[model samples]
Target: MFTLGTYQVHFLTFWCFLKVKRKDRWRNGSKKKFQSQVDRETEFLDVQESDQKLNFKLKGPEGEIQQGTCRYLIGAGGAHSAVRKSLGLKFEGGDYNNEFMLGDVHVKSPQRMKGLHAFFTKEGILAFFPFDDSGNFRVIYGDFKNFDAAKKDLTLEELQFKVDQVGPKGIVLSDPSWLSRFRIHHRMAPCFQMGSIFLAGDAAHIHSPIGGQGMNTGIQDALSLCFKIYLNLRRGAPFELLKGYEQERLPIAKDVLRATDLATQFALSNSLSTRMVKKWLLPFLIEHTPLQKKMAETISQLAISRRDQKIRSNLKIQYP
Candidate 1:
């Protein structure tokens, strides 16, 4: 848990679960105002277009279509957007093959477990985060492919079982607010910009939640693109100026994806080799100040560079 000013903040390292009073969750009226603004700004347009160059028909949700010459397009629909049907963007990546269950529960315990706690069991990774003024806990559990099979609305007995499995037994809960199933995917768009259209956020990259980099990376993507676009618009640059967005962002996304994939693999590994590595080698490395400092620098993102030559050099150092 992290503290800022008068309010206390909790960090759930195991999974992402955030809870606040249903009313106080957002600033007094922020939710309503935000929703109203979203409702007003959102327009679901059905665009149908004939891509004469690709010899394809493009249709949107409402069946409205546009027919025109093909120039350039950017796909920012995110990981869920179908490549073939939507933007014809190729998505190539692997799934984690593990399942994670998360929930929000109200508890009466005085001993609050704060920070990101992980329980590495024979079954999988079970994690918990604390939320709300009433000591509600956000729980994440399971690591096997069958993890979702265990995700039915958890009965009180079932919830107790999970708590017992992850932490010291005898902890009790009074209420559960939310529950859901999730899987990890390590994927990035093969290319960020094809012609004119560019991909950002989940559309450009997807990875395990291990390091909380998903949103950060997406924000970086937005910032990077905004800078480029602003410069291009100010200078009346050609559309090709957008290509640098892809070239610069794609490799960073790929590097993040690779690092996250390794983290997930480490978390899920149970083999004798990994057990030895984790139980012995990992502790030693983490205890060393130099190694720890390097890791800290990497996670802080201060180590990443955007200069083309510097990027190439860092890639060689990290990946090679």
Candidate 2:
């Protein structure tokens, strides 16, 4: 049993088309079916554990229930929308008090550019990610706790005021297609598995989407969980084999949560000292070659290392 929406994807391709194609032709059909049918709103209610199988219920919107039992269960419900208590897993993590506002905006700008622009200012951090189109952009503003207090249906004037509070001059917002407020969080479950039932994606871990890692990490979790299940099915392995998945993946998830938590804090810090550090000191430090290289690697997710490498290398060395 696997909750959907935790599959690995090619970022560039997925962002461009919002679709994922399986690398294996045989798997493509099943993948498409899963993608088409999975419901994000449906919640997993509970998993009843037994000696040889696990029984679970998925509750639909109208109180309808779907009952199922399987030898294995994979919980990929996601970090924010996790059904952990229903699955009998323990979660451990903290929250970042900072809130952020994000939306897509249409702008007529004096400057034409592609790529991401980040503004670190006395008010907060504002970032603009240009879309494939020239006039459309994804804008993000951070550090305003009462962001919700602003106009709910943000008018063009309100949006422009918010943007101007954080950046260079002459940036105007003509129209906004989407807008929403979010709080940053960094947390992970203490365990990713309990017996035959396993947690994946946000259910097991959650972090700030600062480096665009939340979705990516969740997708990787799904891939890893699927691989482990496939191996167990092929080898007729005991459910004990699945425990290794949690042991291996949980630490990595914790690391990601920690890093993203720091990034969120740094992005939203509004204290006078932090403002000075971010606006003035950070850029100066980043100007150094080594610091720039390190920052690049960190944001690119190149710094994470799976314990599998050590396991593989040790096995090879011992065998040789």
Best by TM-score: 2
Query: Which regions in candidate 2 have their CA more than 4 angstroms from the true location?
Result: 1-30, 33-42, 60-62, 80-82, 144-157, 174-177, 235-241, 287-289, 303-305, 308-320
55-163: candidate 2 lDDT, tens digit per residue: 8788887878989888877776666444577755566767666657777776666676455567766556777766656667777777646444443554556557777
Off by over 4 Å in 1: 1-74, 82-85, 104-112, 129-138, 145-160, 173-178, 235-240, 280-284, 308-320
Give per-residue CA lDDT, model 1, range 1-320, as digits (tens).
Answer: 11011111222223333454553655458757656432222322222344423222345446555343433343445677543225566678988777776667765544655654455555566655555445677777655454455455555566567666555556786676666667778877677764445678888789987766887688678766765565456545445556777777888888889888898898787676765665567546655777766666665555876543443343332211
Q: What is the TM-score of each candidate against the true structure?
A: 0.68, 0.76
* Model 1 per-residue lDDT at 300: 51
The TM-score of candidate 1 is: 0.68
User: In model 1, what is the error at residue 209, expressed in angstroms?
Assistant: 1.2
Q: How many residue pairs of model 1 clash at the backbone?
A: 11
The clash count of every prediction, one per candidate, is 11, 3
Report, for every candidate in turn, its global Cα lDDT versus the true structure.
0.60, 0.64
lDDT score for residue 71 of model 2:
82
